[model samples]
Target: MGGLKVLCIAIVLINGQTIGTVAADGPFPDEARRMRSANEFLSPALRAEQADPIRNRGMLWVEQGERLFAQPPPPGGAQSCASCHASPETSMRGVAARLPAVDAESGQLVNLEGRINDCRILRQSLPPLDYETDELLALTAYLTALSIGEPLTVSIDGPASAFYAYGQQLWSERQGQLNVACTQCHDQSVGRKLRGDTISSAVPTGYPAYRLEWQTLGSLHRRLRSCQLGVRAQLFELGSREYLALELYLKSRARRHLIDAPALRR
Candidate 1:
């Protein structure tokens, strides 16, 4: 083991007055320890499928996303996402890896999905897309795919620190009838066989991914809810603060791991 991983906290000041406390780096795994992507644990056949765009079922959603990105805003709208962001390959590159960030305006955490909906509602003058909708998943998968190979760098500083702490709490706290904590499975039993499936490190980099069990692409929150159900816990609403905070903590654990969105999972 290397040096202890420490949480870095800072105090915000204004005119020599302490305003608030911020955590620059929440409690994270040791820096010297390498965190592997969930893709590394994939079966050879599924790995091959994930690698080949033509063979990957998740790519279908990506394609739909591309079309949706270029689609014009409804009548009377100012511009489409394409009009503002231009080519996603050029403008949107590496964007996904930095999400679940605190929105400056709302001072609330917003993931990639939340950001997209924000654009639609505020800029495009359209209604927010529903969670888990084909349109939302497609667009999210498309943007995430563009960040393939990019390392996760989600921030957990400032107001986000509180949320990160909550997420950390949730990760370690035992819940549900089974009284299972996320750490017991993801951190302690990684690589172990679980009902025919190998446990992963609970990385968020591979979502909105294709899951054979679901037979379709789904968001990280959806998967989280599934885990809750697996342990006989109550499910939280999609896009809820609890899940968003948990997503932030999960991404922080996967810091520097290359993104594998639109990934295939058994």
Candidate 2:
């Protein structure tokens, strides 16, 4: 009799566990199927991190960048970014909303970081900062913060059209040993668990993000390169044309979304 009772309880426990999973991962309601960025999905704790300057690790890097802007290292008699721009809140406001712009000097599309480096070299007579460095990430995060709450607005027409189109193609093209495209994962798997992590929309809005996995801040391009590597695809160099094109395309997709860079991601 005791054995039968134990068996009955086991069955009930198994049924309850199955039901709980089905409830949690059940089919999304029609309204829920409409895609939303991770911003809308942020848990209370995550939201607090974004709101509280002290808790938001990204704020540390932004503050470092702010200090760098006011007192840049001297190389070739370089001047601080603040010398000309003054307070970032005033001088740099809304600047990121118009980025991935065609540089008149290079006739190439340039993101905010590239433009910053361009200024460092041409105006300040300093060498371009290397990609993924602490100072670079800090500065990029700082600039991105200025545009927070502003809508994403990359140029997709005129000279930028060709680059934008190339980016669109790259998104759909299959690569890597798994033969998966970005859309296969980001578009389809969004809001679903993959390898124990929630896949998100490949939005550029909350970039220069502080990823918990990486335990560091990095540019959007850095995140893209990591994904490309994940699928065993050949990686593009940082600031390369391919990456820039893709960045522009990603930003275009999120044009209607608000800028929320330096965001935390699991």
Choose the strongest candidate by TM-score.
1
TM-score of every prediction relative to native: 0.87, 0.84
Across 155-218, the per-residue lDDT of candidate 1 in tens digits comes to 8788889989999999999999999999899988988998888898777778998999999999
Alpha-carbon lDDT of model 2: 0.76
How many clashes in candidate 1? 0
**What tens-digit string does per-residue lDDT give for candidate 2 at 1-266?**
35633212110000011100111243443422344666655666877776666677888788777767877657565687887887668678778878898987778999989988988988788888988899899989888887776666677889999999999899889999878899888787788877666787776777898988789998888999988988999999999999999999887876656677778877
Which residues of candidate 2, in runs, are more than 4 Å off?
Answer: 1-35, 72-75
Q: Please list the residue runs of candidate 1 whose C-alpha ends up more than 4 Å from where it truly belongs after superposition.
A: 1-34
Q: List the residue pairs that clash in candidate 1.
A: none
Instruction: Please give the lDDT score for candidate 1.
Output: 0.82
- Of candidate 1, the 10-residue stretch with the lowest lDDT total is 12-21
